[model samples]
Target chain A: MAQGNFILREKEYLALQASLKKLLANSYAKVVFLVDKNGSLIASAGATGDFDTTSLASLTAGNIAATGGLASLIGEKEFSILFHEGERDNMHISVVANRIILVVIFDRRSSVGLVRLRVRRTATELERILRDIDAGAGKEEEGDFEELTEADIESLLK
Target chain B: MSFINYSSREINCKIVYYGPGLCGKTTNLQYIYRRTNPESRGKMISLTTDTERTLFFDFLPLSLGEVRGFKTRFHLYTVPGQVFYDASRRLILRGVDGVVFSADSQLTRMDANVESLENLQVNLREQGYDSDRIPLVMQYNKRDLPHVASVAELHALLNYRNVPEFEAVATTGVGVFETLKAIIKLILIDLKKGGR
Candidate 1:
């Protein structure tokens, strides 16, 4: 099982951003984002400025988790992909590498078929980057937090 | 799980508020949401039933300025405390970095409080976290209510690990930030020691 905590270095972060950008462009989606299963917004591209990406990431994760629970109740591992259709827009949410969630939002400009195809291709690249991240996890430069003090934490609350 | 993104200069941590039903878990987050500055917080999302009980979870995203140049973001969550929502509660604990166990202080809720704490431990273990090792704080909520248990009684019943404990009237926002701050401090200390 993969540990929940991990560090995302600049190298993999840029790679993830590039992959999301390409998926957004190819799928003709309004926005594409990558979120950790824990609901942290890792990276995003496209028309994210118009929406609250934080809430979007969180709700997406929650939706996936709830669906996953249902899947297990029926003796399935998980429902890797979920779709929600709205009158004006649609959301395509899928689990990548069983850890990260890939979300694409689109409207009349795209179809589910196109989004599915684009996500399939991008999911591979995303998984590769995630593996790279896992391989290099915990190897970051140390001592960054060694000097941290309780006073420093107190200052933030102030 | 705590995600440290060096590229974005941000550290994101998930802290969950857990307790039995009507123990003021949601009230704690609501209080923080209302008191927080608009610029430092994101929209608060509550997935509740028609009757307003939490059916899934309540999420609040907060930015606690910065620590050592990296922006610190804490995503707060409250699990549905009703017993039947055990599965939903387990999902919310998937990647939790810390937990604030909100214990209702009413004398009659002692059994409920004990049961909820045990549930929290079992769920945390299933998610690969050791109950004792995880960063946890105890909030004795609804302190102002009539016929409440004394702090000593509540502590003796709920806090076997002897973690930091606070008395809170969550409806009035009293001790809300104190509980939150204590958990955050423990999480940061854990991170410095290499996160679990």
Candidate 2:
């Protein structure tokens, strides 16, 4: 349950990148990414070369949402951390501030214990940044978008 | 909810196609997936049962060429419409920005259509979204069927709020893009008011 209508700003994204970098450095994970609860990739740090993160982000959100549903059905609040183990690659998905998801994808290079410990520390900083961003979001900024004409929409129809 | 990525110069929106089971919601996504250019569309993923009934959801990410220097991406998802899959449907609508209610046009499925519409409203509320405030469009599908109900009748029954209802035979691609475009238009208009 991310705050409604998430708008990413450059300043906030920079801060997020810094946090994600800290997590990856501390954990030695292959990649660390952040996705809104609704499944949008807010930012990613570390190596994601030649990978399709859009689909990954969408499916990650779906997996977590379904897990949350299953949690509530059994009278639990939420299953905060989801980990998938593979022969070569593993993923750790944790909830941040109940609004965003923090995912750390790694290999045998890092142990689950290390990723978990680093994520716990990183989540706090990321949550603070998200709260600040949400506080400043949704404002009709000056020239936020170039004025769209009916023709712009019509062109899409074509 | 719409996610505007300033860094990527992109705006992403989630649009869900909701309806009773087998009411052409999946077909709508298929047709759009087929018609779109390879560069602009991502792989269409369908999570389904062995019988091909949508078990969880179908996700299709489409890029409508950049508008005003920002790429507009619509992540279209279809909810599992079976009555037994109510919990899955609620999860899919959690942060949806727009909804396209695909109603079955057959007279025999009239009650199912009404029930699904009401179910959608209830699910939206449960997710903390106002059904009235969210951008919504109605598509009376399977109109090519000989025994389908008329648009007027579907309107009287399903389109209580009169949200830009369209008559679509989704299998053949008729009115598919139109329904999609209409909802995106409404979403963009709403985005203009408050979205930065």
lDDT by residue for model 2 (B105-125), tens: 999999999999999989998
What is candidate 1's TM-score against the reference? 0.98
lDDT of 1 by residue, A59-116 (tens): 9999999999999999999999998999999999999989899999999999999999
DockQ of each: 0.66, 0.52
Best by DockQ: 1
Residue-level lDDT tens digits of model 2 in A1-158: 22356788878889999999999999999999999888888899988775578888889999999999989989999999999999999999999999899999999989999999999999999988988887877555424544776677678657
How much of the real interface does each model capture, measured as fnat? 0.66, 0.49
Cα lDDT, model 2, residue A101: 94
What is the C-alpha lDDT profile of model 1 across B19-72, one tens digit per residue? Answer: 999999999999999999999999999999999999999999999999998999
lDDT of 1 at B149: 94
DockQ of model 1 vs. true complex:
0.66
Q: Relative to the unseen true structure, what is the C-alpha lDDT of residue B67 in candidate 1, on a scale of 0 to 100?
A: 95
